[model samples]
Target: MQRPAYGQSPPLHHPVPQHVSTVPQLRSPPPPIPQQQHQQQAHGYDGSPYQQQPMGAGPSHNVFGQYGNFMNDPAAQLASQFSQTAFKQGTQYLEQNVNRYVNVSALKHYFNVTNSYVINKLFLVIFPWRHKPWSRKQTVGPNGQEGWYLPPRDDINSPDMYIPVMSLVTYILLSTLIAGLRGQFQPELLGYTASKALGVVVLELVGLKLGCYFLSISNESQLLDLVAYSGYKFVGVIGTISLAEIVNKGKGTGGWFGWSVFLYMFLANSLFLMRSLKYVLLPDNHGDARGPMQTGDTRAKRNQRTQFLFIYSYVVQFAFMWFLSRP
Candidate 1:
């Protein structure tokens, strides 16, 4: 090493530094500060008190959370209650309207029956020859009326709407099935078939009403009874059609065997009606206590009514069956 002079020019030499290692040294990171200490440090830096808030302590941060809060709101709860009350009131109004025209309690009686009664009634409708005493058994009703007929559960001869309703529905479904099998089915065909069946029922009802009016035998309660008896023909019609289908195997409704089955069913149904309607048409012969005492003119009128009953049981049934069975 050489030193430089203060005032005079002189040669100078710089000192050499020491060598440093090229490899890096490893060191652990410092431990994290506590939450309180961190918050205090932030407060000191900002000159204000810093609050450490818990998770979700502020306003809702997600859509689901906001929706939950809204549902708990009092306004939303009140709206829900109002909708429920409106629905109940609407249901009550509809029920009141329906009960105005229809006798629901009386209708329920015709549907009161058991499996055994259904089976036995079906047998009687199909094969009515051996059955005796077509008269219905009378029973004391809840109101103590004496003329009320026994429920179908107790008497197989009693008329019931159950079989008729079930048979009618089955007939419509079967008709649709047969039409589909025969390749004559259409979407509109269902509506057409239903309309036609309902129309036939309406026409028959109208004719019966007209006949009763002319014969001076009009009755409101008996209307349901007449409808039930008239609907029994559907059972035979169903049997005849089903047999015809099975025999022909979806081919058609025309054959010697089909015709034979149809003729037999028609005759059986005619006989069933003849026996069943005797009580309704000729109340005098059946010993109905509700009927008035017979007079000479009433007796003569009953003779004419007897002829009408025969015509209805045979002629009307045959015509209707033939029409229904047509392909």
Candidate 2:
């Protein structure tokens, strides 16, 4: 190569060569510097302004707190800690079934009917009937000696016996008619004493009778009128039992107590009234099944004998009624 003059430019030409040698040159690219590829993880976006810290390590973000200092405080854990979130969760849970509907009007009517029946029964329990006094007499014989015949004590003061006995009889007849009308003839269903069923009938009848009498709506008692009201109580009890059984986790034991003890009051009172009936209604009816009357026989046979005595005793009742009707 020769340097060109300052004033003249060199001519661009290739020189003719007799022989040529070629050499390969090696130049490596700068060792690729590992350019870190920033990636987004589940915790946060790659370009997020705020940094994420390990959970429970630093001050926790208290969703519900007066000051950030109380954020990580375990003692501050409360329902309000995530109240809005919890409320949202709860709202979503409830909203999932918001379309569900219940028969509220029917339930309300049913409760009304039950309360009405209870009120009527209370009236029957409190109302005073004519009190009959037992009469004793001393007979004077030819020798001027007085022989005394002891009089039995009447049960005017016993509310338990009186209320239950009257209620039972009234209910039996009332429910029999209701069941008969509903095209049911299974007397066995009637054979079992269900206080609530019986209460329904008796209270309904009493309510209808009293309402009609008081309001001067009608003097006569129709079978349908009693059945209609009793049906209400019956339906009410069924509804209550159904709701408690279905909606509550508690077992049916509590329901049984409610049915047996409070609503029915049948078992305890039945024993009492059954005992009183023998002594009060059938004195001569000496059936072990009978109250004070003593007899040796099976329960069924005793009941049969006692029924006959009861029929006989009713003659005395009619006579007493007739005497009372006298001026």
Candidate 3:
């Protein structure tokens, strides 16, 4: 070791290190663990630890953080579920049954129906004789439902609901106009006309259903088919009424114009129904011509059935519509 300089700090002396003894004090054993804890360890838990997931907060975009708890009500959740279920059920029911008697989609198949076609169909209703026979233009869809590929030009069996629906509205409006022109218009009259038209439709539908049952045509399930058939009279009625409206404006006719139109429409409607409803009412190729096994009793019965249906569909329906359409 070198000696310190005169002006520098002197070197410090180091004390010898002494070992301090960690006294081996007697240690007390940890207090005995509770029996309850031991039991818990042995049995895991009394009930399921993960009973259910915590409900998450629903999305509330741009909402203040304080109001983030909205839409979390249990009753609201239950009501939402109920409404969703009810809506689903109601729509499903309507979808299936709405088209049972009238398929609106079938009427508006753009390729099959047009303005020109709609106008042309009026003549078909007036002159059903021009249509020779029911054409076999049925096509089976992917869902196994059969439908027309294109409506037959003049056949009564051509189920064109568009004509009936359109002509019905037209007929109502025309009748209303005629009534208004004569100062006979009433708010209730509109209701009367609409109700009358609808009543006739329902009545006709029921009548056809019954007719098919009594006749046992085996085609009664074609209820909408018959509905379309029955609606044809509206066309002739509408046409006749329109013609009468023009003729009555001559000032001397009093109201003969309306009466004259009613009579002519009656005749025209009868003819149309007679021709169109025959296939349903009358079986073509009567007698032994149809089959060798055909019995005389069966033939006679069919003839009688045909006669009954001819009158029931033509005369009876014409009377009903004629009476109802009176302003």
Candidate of highest lDDT: 1
Which segments of candidate 2 are over 4 A away from where they belong? 1-195, 219-223, 253-327
Ranking by lDDT: 1, 3, 2
Summing lDDT over every window of 10 consecutive residues in candidate 2, give the lowest-scoring window: 150-159
Q: Per-residue alpha-carbon lDDT of model 1 for 1-327, expressed as tens digits?
A: 777678888757787655547556789975566865775444443234464544553343456698899999999999999999999999989878988987777788799999999999999998899999888888787898777777788998888999988988887888988999888888987887777767777787788778877777634466778888878878877887898899899766689988998899899999998988777776763457554324544667988879888998999989988887776
In Å, residue 139's CA in model 3 sits off its true spot by 5.0
Provide the overall lDDT of each model, using Cα atoms, as 2-decimal numbers: 0.80, 0.38, 0.63
Error in Å for residue 148 of model 3: 7.4
Tens-place lDDT per residue, model 3, 114-164, is: 566666667666655566664324465568755434454433245566788
Please identify model 3 stretches exceeding 4 Å from their true place: 1-90, 93-112, 134-157, 250-263, 283-297
Q: Quick one: ranking by TM-score, best first? A: 1, 3, 2
- Which candidate would rank higher by lDDT, 1 or 2? 1
TM-score of 1: 0.73
> Which residue pairs show backbone clashes in model 1?
none
As a whole number from 0 to 100, the lDDT of residue 275 in candidate 2 is 39
